[model samples]
Target: MAETKKTSATPTKVAKKEKMLRVTLVKSPIGYCKDQRQTAVALGLNKLNSSNELPDNSAVRGMIFKIKHLVRVEEI
Candidate 1:
C-alpha cells in the first residue's frame, strides 16, 4: 500500500512602495506674491538654497507646482 499527501493553494501579491521627492528653494521669493511666499514657508523652505524631502503625493505636488518658478524638484 502507498500513502498520499495533500497540499493547499495560496495566492501571491505584489508589495507597494512609497516614493519621495526633493524640493529645493533655488530662487528667492521676496518679490513673489504673498501666497507664493506662504507656500515656500509651508514647505519648510524659509531661506535660499534650502531643501526638503517630502512624500510624492498630490498635496505636496500641488504646493511644488505653485512655486515651480521659485524652486527645483528631484526624484529620490
Candidate 2:
C-alpha cells in the first residue's frame, strides 16, 4: 500500500562559497618556454602587472605552477 503525507515548510537559504585566488603577472614571460607563456596568457595575464581573480582550484593552481616564476599568487 502507498500513503501520502502533506507538509508545509519553507526552504532556508543556503550559501555556497568558493575561495578565490589572486594572480598577478609580476615579470615578463619572454624567453620562457612557449607553454609557460601560453599558460600565463590563459590565466588572463597578457602583460606585466596584469592581474586576475581566479578560483582556487586544482586547474588554476596547475596553471599558476606552470608560470610561477612569471607571476605571483595570493589567496583571498
Candidate 3:
C-alpha cells in the first residue's frame, strides 16, 4: 500500500509578479517597412521620444525585436 503525505493548510509565500518593459520610440518609423511601422504602433509608440510601459512577455518582446531599429527597450 502507498502511504499518503500530510499537507499543511498554511498559505505559501509564492506570489505572481509581472515584469515590466519600458519601451521608447527613439526614432521615426517613416520610410521603414510597413510591418515595422505597424509593430511600433501596436506597442503604443506613435511619436518620437514617446514611451510606454508594457508587460515583459514574449509577444511584447517580439514586437520590440521587429522594430528594434526604430525604438529602444529597457527593463523596469
Candidate 4:
C-alpha cells in the first residue's frame, strides 16, 4: 500500500494599511484643465478655501500633483 501526503492550506492575505491626506483648495480652478476641475470636484472641493480628506493613494497623489499650484496637501 502507498501512503498519501497532505498539503497545508493556503495562507491568508493581510489587508494593507490605508493612509489619508488632507487636501485643501487654496486657489481657484478657473482656466485649469477640465480634468483638474473634475479632480477637485471629486475631492469635494468646489470653491477656494475648501478642503477634503482623501486616501493617500497613487491616483489621489497624481491628481494632487497635477494641481499642486491650486491645492495644499498635508499628511493625516
TM-score of each: 0.78, 0.82, 0.79, 0.71
Per residue, candidate 2 scores C-alpha lDDT tens digits across 7-61 of 6587766987889999999999899889998899899999889999999999999
Is 1 or 3 the stronger prediction by lDDT? 1
lDDT of 4 by residue, 46-69 (tens): 988988998998988888888899
In model 3, where do residues sit more than 4 Å from their true spots?
A: 1-15
For model 4, name the residue pairs that clash: none
lDDT leaderboard ranking: 1, 3, 2, 4
- lDDT per model vs. reference: 0.93, 0.90, 0.91, 0.89
Which tens-of-lDDT digit does each residue in 36-76 have in candidate 1? Answer: 99999999999999999999999999999999999999999
lDDT per residue as tens, model 3, 1-76: 9999988889778878889999999999999889888898899998899999999989999899888888888999
- The TM-score, computed over Cα atoms with residue i paired to residue i, of candidate 3 is 0.79
Q: For model 3, what is the alpha-carbon lDDT of residue 26?
A: 91
The true-versus-predicted C-alpha distance at residue 8 of model 3, in Å, is 10
| Candidate with the greatest TM-score versus the true structure | 2
- Count of backbone collisions within predicted model 3: 0
Looking at candidate 2, the ten consecutive residues that score lowest on lDDT are 4-13
In the order shown, the candidates' Cα RMSDs to the true structure are 4.1, 4.5, 5.4, 4.0
Worst 10 residues of 4 by lDDT: 4-13
